[model samples]
Target chain A: MLSSPGGNPHHPSTVAELGEFGLIRELTSRLDTTPSVHLGPGDDAAVVAAPDRRVVATTDILLEGRHFRRDWSTAYDVGRKAAAQNLADVAAMGAVPTALLLGLVVPAELPVNWPTELMDGIRDEARVAAAAVVGGDVTRGDVITVAITALGDLRDKAAVTRSGARAGDVVAVTGWLGWSAAGHAVLSRGFRSPRAFVEAHRRPEPPYHAGPAAAGLGATAMTDVSDGLIADLGHIAVASRVRIDVRSRQLDVPLQMSDIGQAVGVDPLQWVLTGGEDHAIVATFPRDRKLPARWRVIGEVLPPTGTPQVTVDGAPWDRAGGWDHFGPDQD
Target chain B: MLSSPGGNPHHPSTVAELGEFGLIRELTSRLDTTPSVHLGPGDDAAVVAAPDRRVVATTDILLEGRHFRRDWSTAYDVGRKAAAQNLADVAAMGAVPTALLLGLVVPAELPVNWPTELMDGIRDEARVAAAAVVGGDVTRGDVITVAITALGDLRDKAAVTRSGARAGDVVAVTGWLGWSAAGHAVLSRGFRSPRAFVEAHRRPEPPYHAGPAAAGLGATAMTDVSDGLIADLGHIAVASRVRIDVRSRQLDVPLQMSDIGQAVGVDPLQWVLTGGEDHAIVATFPRDRKLPARWRVIGEVLPPTGTPQVTVDGAPWDRAGGWDHFGPDQD
Candidate 1:
C-alpha cells in the first residue's frame, strides 16, 4: 500500500499537499519521450506525428471498485491494465499506437506516491506498445477513475474494422484467453498460488504487435478480446453481418486454469469461452491465407442466417453474459 | 428529472434496463458524421483524418458532484460543458477540431435519457466546431464521470504553444471572461434567476475559431482562459520564461456581473481577474503586430522576474488561486 505510513516529515504525503502544479511536475518528470510524440506532456495539447494521415482512437474507463479494487490490485497494476486495454483497442484496428492521454480522477488525500507509481505503470505499458504519454488532466473526485484515450497510426494501411469480416473468413486469436478469468476466480476465492493467472488479472499482456501483423497478412476483421471471446466476436458478427462458430476443442486452456476450475467446481471451458479482460488479439482472415505459428485457428465465419451471432459447436452458448458493465454489480 | 416519474411503465427508464449495446446504439445513432472522421463510432477504434500529419490531442474529466451538480444542471449541460472544456484545449493549441471521444462512467440506475442527452450535448458541441463523435466507452460505476478526449488537425501549421510568448509581446484576449465564475457565484447562493449567467455556468461558449485565427495572425503564444486570466497567463509566463502584467482598467465586465457581485458583496473585478472556466482565448502577440478587432489587448509580457508570473497592473495579484482541481473542495 502506497497510502502513506506517515514516515517522511519533509516530503508531501498526499496529492493535496503536493498541489496540482507540483503533482503535475512530479508525474511528468518521471516519463521519457517517444518517437511518436512531437510535443509531449506540459503543453495545452500533445502533437503526435500521424504520418499515416489518419489516426486511430479509442477510450476506456476503469473505476476503482467497478473495474479494479485497490485492496486486490496496486495502483501500478491498475494503471498498466488501463493502458493495455486502450492500446489493445488501437492495435485491434491494425494501427500502431502513437500516443496516450489520461483523464484521471482521484481523491485529494490519496497518497502522492500512488498516482506517481500509476504514471510509471502507464508509461511502462505504453512503452511496450511503442507509444508515449502525451498529455492528461488530473482532477479531485470521491471515486478513483482512470480514463485513457490511445491514438494510433495505420501507416498507410486501411484500418481493420469490425465490419470487414467475410463469410469465408477463418477466426484466429493470439495471447491468453482464460487466464484473466481464472485469475479473477483465484483472487475471489482468496487464494493466490497461481501467480501467472493472478498477474494476468492484475496486468494484461496484450499482443499489441500481432494486430498490425495480422493486418499485414490481410486480416478481414480484428478485435481485442476484452469482453469474452464470444461476446466480442458477436461484435464482429453483427458488424460484418456474418455468423461465427467456435470450436471449444481448439481452445488450449493451460493445466493451471483447469486445476483452478476443478478446485472451484467450474468448467475451464467457461472461462475460455466467456471470460473477459484477457485482451487477446482476435482476427478473421481469408480461409485460403496461411496464418503464422502464433495465430491459432479457433472458429470460422459463415453467412448470417437470421440475426448475426456467435455459437459454440454450431449452437448458441447457453451462458450469454460477458462482462456487461451494466448487467449487475457485485459490489 | 428524467429519473422515472414512475410513468411509462413499459419503457426501460434506467441504464441498467437499457443494457450496454442498446445504450450504445441509441447514443451512436444520434450523432452525425464529420469530414475529419474516416470511420466513426461502432468499431474497434474510430479512424480520424489528421491531414496535418500530426494530431493534437487533449483530455479532461468531469465527476458528478465535484465538477457538476445533477440537480442544478441537466445531463445535456454536463455533456456540453465536458466537450467544450476539451475542445477549448485543442483550440488553445491552434488546432482545428477533428473528433471527440467520450469515456463515461455512470451509476447503473442513472436515467437512460441522461446519457443519451449527454451524448446529444456532446454531438451538438462537436458540430459547433465541425468535429465528429468518433468513439467512446461506457461502464457502470457509483459516481458519474465524463471523460472526454478531443483531437484536432493543425492544417499544416505549427502548434502555438504556451512557451512561445516573447518579452516584447502584448497579451490580448477574446470571448467571455469571468462570466462562468460570476454564474457560479449565482448558483452557489441557491439563487437561479439571472438566467443568462446561470446558463453560462451550465454551458460555456468557448471562442474556438479565435484560436486558429490567432495562429494565422502571428500570435507569439496562446492559451484558453479556463483557469482565470491571471492563472492561465501565469502558465504562459512560466512556460515562456517571461512576466505578464494585466491592466484591470482595460478589462470590460458586463453590468449584470457587477450587479450580481454587488448583491453578493464581492468585487466583480475579482471575478474578472481571478475567476475561471469562461474558456476565452488569450494570446500574446508582438507589440508592433496588429490584432483583429475581436482581440482586446489587456497586458504586456516582460523579461523574467524573480519568478516568471502574471501580475495585476505591475504587482502580483494577491488572490492568486484559480480553479485548482486538487485544492480544497466545496462539496
Candidate 2:
C-alpha cells in the first residue's frame, strides 16, 4: 500500500511556499491523454471534439468541511464522490458522459501525494463511466474545494428533461433510495454499520447506464435522486404540471436500512421518502411502455390541481426532510 | 447601492425558515434563458450545440482570501475577472466562447444578494463574449470560492497550439503586458498607480477577437500571457523546439501603464517583459504574413540549440521571472 504522506509533520510546507505556478506544474505532471484531446495541459485551453453536435453539461462543487471532512473521508473518496455526483447528473439527462474538467483548490501546506490519490479516484470513476479526464486547473485556497464539470454526448437521443412527464405516466426508479441518508445518519451518530451503509455514504454507487437505457425505452421525464426521493420527484411534478403519488408499500422491499431506522427511532419509510444522495435514476414513462430491468414501478403521475405536490399513499408527508446546504441539519 | 448581507448573522433561523426545496425554488426563480439553451437549470443536464465539431474548454478557481480579498474586489468584479480569465483561454485556442458553468461555495451566513451580483457580473461578461451561463451547483463552505468551466466553438479553424512555431517565424503580441503585474505591485506595496495600471490589475481588457484573427492570418503558434511574457514565450520555445529572441527596443510605444511604471521607479520595459495576468494574445506568424493593426512584431523564432531558451537582444536575460504558482513569491 502506498501510504499517503498527507498531513505529515515532517513536510511542514504551506501553499505559499510552493507558489501558484509551480504547484500547477507539479499537479499536471505525469497525466496522460488520448487522441480525442487536441491540446492538453500547458496550453491556454484544451480542444475536444463533440462529434454529435450537441453537448450535455453539468457542474458540482464539494467543499472541504461541509461536503466531506478530511478526518472522516479520505482524499480518494472525496474525489470519487465529487466526480460521481456530476456524472450522475449527465446520466439523469439521458446522456453518455464523455469528458470531465476539474478545478481543485487547497492550502499550500497540503501533502503533495493527497492530490495524486484524489486523481486516482477521479480517474477510476471516469473509467467506470467510460469518460476521460480531459483537463483541469489547480490553485491555492484556504480549504480543499473540488469543482467538476462533466460533458456528455446525447447520441441523437432526445434529452429527458424534468418537464415532460404527463398525467397517467408511470413513475419508476432504478437502484436504491434512502441508503445514503441512512449511512449519513449512522456516520453522524457515530454508530457502526455492516460496511454496506458506510460504503454508501463514502462512495455512492449510482446506476450509471440506466439513464441511456431509460431514454431508449422512451422515458418522458427523469432526474437523479440527489435530494430526497419525494423532494426530487416533486421537481419533476412541478415542471411537468403533474402530481406524483408514491406508494409506501413499494419502497419496503428495497429499503434496506430498517435496522438502522429502528436504532435511530426514525421511520425507514421516511428515509426512503425524503433521504437523498442515493443517486438513483428516476423517470416517468408512458403507462404502455415496457419498463427496463432493475427499474421498479413505485408510483403514477396525475394532473396537477391547486398546488404541485408529491404525496405518499394519498397523504402529504410531514416528516421534516430533504438535504439543504443553507438549512439546519436534521436526521 | 445595495449592501451585501454576506456577513449577516440572522440568516438561518429555523429549518422551516428557508426549507431546502423552497430555497432552490427561490434562487432559480427569475433566471431567464436564451433560445440556444435546449435545456435550462431545473433539469438533470443542459444540452447545448457545439456546431463547430470541436469544443475549446478551460476551468479556473478563485478563492475569497487568496485570489481576491473581499474588501479589494467587489462581488461583481470578482465574477467578471473569473469569467474573463476562462473566456480568454478559449480565445487563446482561436475559438469563440459558447457557454459557462459556474460552481460557487459560500458560508450559509453569506448574504443572498452577493450571489446575484456575482451572477450579474458573469452575465455581463458573457454578453461581451457572446456566451451564456448554462448551469451550476452551489454549496456551503468556509470561504467563498468560484469555479468556472468555459466552453467555446472553434468555427472550423484549427486550434493554434503552443507547439506549432517554426524557425524564422515572427513573434508578435496584441494587448498590453506587465500592466497587471505592475498593478499587483502597486496594490500590494501600497503604491498609487496612474489609474490605468490599477484598473488593469483588477480587470484585464484582453483582446479577445485577436486570437481567431491570428488563426485566420495563419499564425503558427499562440498562447495567452498569463505568466510573464518571457516565461509564457519560453514555454512555446520549448514545446516547438525553437529559440526565441526578443528586441526590447521595439516596445517603446506609450501604453497607458508607462506613467505608472515611471512613478514607481520600475522600468516600463521590465513590466512589459515580466508582468503577468495581462491576458494578452501572443502568436508567431510567418515572416511574410500581414500583421493585425494592434499587434506589433517584437521577436523572431530561431533554430533550436541543445536547450530551449529565450534571449533579449542576443543575450540571455538573468532576472527574477515567470509566474510560478509553487515558486517563491517575489513580493
Candidate 3:
C-alpha cells in the first residue's frame, strides 16, 4: 500500500488533506499510458482514437455494501470486478475494449491506499483485454461508488446486439455459470471451505476474447450474463422477439461442488438459473453455424409466440426471480 | 410528469415496484436518438459512430446534496446541470459532443416521475449541442446519484489540451463567470429574488460552440470553468509549464448584482475568481491571433518561474480558495 506523500503510513493523508488535485495526481501517477490512449489523464477529457470510427460504449456503477462488502472483498477485488463487468459489456457487443474512464466517489476518510490499490486492480484487469485506464474523476461522497465507462473498437465488424437473435438460432454461452451465485451463498452461510467458490464471488473473469470470436463465428446476438442466465437471455429474447429454450441437461454449472451446495441446503439448479454477476457471455448463433471451441450449445431459439419469452427444457420457468437492484435485501 | 403504465397519477409506481428493466424503459422512452448514435438503449452496449476515428471522452459523478439539492433545484435542473458539466468537458477539448451515457442510482421509494422529469431535462439540454442520450442504466441506492459519460467528435482537428499553452499567449474566456457562485450565494442566504442568479446556480449554459470556434481560430490550449477561474487556470499553468496572470479588471462579472453580493457580505470578485460551475470556456491563444467575437481576453501567459503558477495583476493573489469536495462545506 502507498502511504501519503509525507511518507508516513501511520498517519496517511485523508482525501481532505491531499485535496482533489493532489489526490488525483497521486492516483494517476500509477497508470501507464497505452498507444491507443492518444491523451491520458491530466487532460480535461481523454482522446481515444478508434480508427474504425464506430465505438462500443458501456457504463456501470457499483456501490459499496450493495455490490460488494468490504469485509467480504478486498479493494483490489472490488476494482477488478468493476472493470471486468463493464469491459464484459463491450465484449458482449463484440468489440475489443481499448479504453476506460472511471468515476469514483468515496468518503473523505477512505484510505488513500484504497484508491491506489483499486486503480492497480483496474489496470491489471484491463490489461487482460488489452485495455487501459485513460481518464477518471474522483469526488467526495458518503459511500464508495465506482462508475466506469468503457469504450471499445469493433475493428469494422458490425456490433452484435441482443436484437439480432432469430428463430432457429442456437443459444450458446462461454465462461462459467452460477459460480458467483454459488460463491455468494457459500460466503453468506459462513462456510470458509471451497475457496474457488468464494473467489468467484470476489473476482469474476469474463471471457473477453470469446465475444469477438463468437462475433466472427457469425453470432446472431450476444449479451453478458451479469444478471443470471434466464434474465439476461430474457433481454435477448425480448430484444429479438424470439422464444428461447434452455436445455437443462446441457448447462455446465459446477454441480461437482456438491459439498458446498449441501452445506448451503440450496438446489444447485436454482443458483444456475437465477444467479447474477457471473460475467459470462450468453449468445445466439445460427443453428447450422459451427461454433468455436470456447462456446457450448445450451439452448435453441424459436419464433416469438406472440411475445418474447424464455423457457427451460420446453417448460416455462416457475421460479423466474433474478437479481433486482431495488428488491428487498436478502442478506 | 409521466405516470406509470397504469396512467393513474394519484398512485404512481416506485422504482422498486417497477423493477430495473421496467424503470429503465420508462426513463429511456423520453430520450431521442441522434444520427451519430448507431444504436440506442436496450442493448448490451451503445454504438456511436464518430466518423472522425478519434473520440474525446469525459465522465463525472454528481451526488445529491453535494452537487445539487432537491429542495434548492428541481429534478429537471439537476439533470440538466449534470449533462452540461460533462458536455462542457468535451467542448473544452474542442470536440463536438455526439453521445451521452447516463448512470443513475436512486432510492427505491423515489417517485417514478422524478427520473422521467430528469430525462426530459437531459434530452432538452443535449439538443443544444446536437447530442443524444444514447444509453443509460438505473439502479437503487440511498441517494440520487448521476454519472454521465460524454463522447465527442474532433472532426479531424487536433484536440486542444491544457498542455499546449506557451509564453506570450493570451488567456481569454467565453460564457459567464461567477454567476453560479453568486446564484449559490443567493440561494444559500434564503433570498428568492434575483431569479436569474438563482437559475444560473440551478442550470449553467456552457459556451459549447465557442470551444470548436476557438480551436478553429488556433487557440493553443483550452479547459472548461467547472472549477473556479484561478483553480482551473492553475491546471492549465501546471500542464503547460507556463505562468498565467489574470487581469481582474478585464472580468465581466455581474457587478450589477452587487446588492445581492453586499447582502451576502461577500466580495462579488471572490465569486468571479473562485466560483465554480459556470461551464465557461477558458483558453489560451497567440496574442497576435485574431480571436473570434465570442472570445474576450482576460490575461496573458508568462514564462514559467521554475514552477507553474498563476498571478493576478503581476502579483500572486492572496485569495486562492476554491470549491473542494472534501474540504469544508461553505454556504
Predicted model with the maximum lDDT: 1
- Give the per-residue Cα lDDT of candidate 1 at A32: 82
Which residues of candidate 1, in runs, are more than 4 Å off? A1-7, A320-331, B1-9, B320-331
- lDDT score, candidate 2, position B300: 94
Clash pairs for candidate 1? none
Looking at candidate 2 chain B, the ten consecutive residues that score lowest on lDDT are: B322-331
What are the per-residue Cα lDDT tens digits for candidate 1 across A1-331?
Answer: 2233236777788988988877888888878888778999887899999998899999998888778899999888988999999999999999999899998887899988889878989999999999989999998888888999999999998899999999989999999998888888888879886899899989999999999999999999999998899989999998899999999999998887888877876677788987889899999999999999999999999999875389898988866254332222112
Give the Cα error of residue B87 in candidate 3, in Å: 0.5
Model 3 Cα displacement at B236 (Å)?
A: 0.9
| Tens-digit lDDT string for candidate 2 (B163-183) | 999998999999878777777
Give the lDDT of residue B232 in candidate 1. Answer: 92
The A-chain TM-scores of all the candidates are 0.94, 0.90, 0.93
TM-score list, all predictions = 0.93, 0.90, 0.93
The CAPRI-style docking tier of model 1 reads high
Best by DockQ: 1
Give the alpha-carbon lDDT of every model.
0.87, 0.78, 0.85
Candidate 2, residues A75-176: lDDT per residue as tens digits?
788878888988899999998887889899877777677676777778778777887787888887778888999888787899999999999999999977
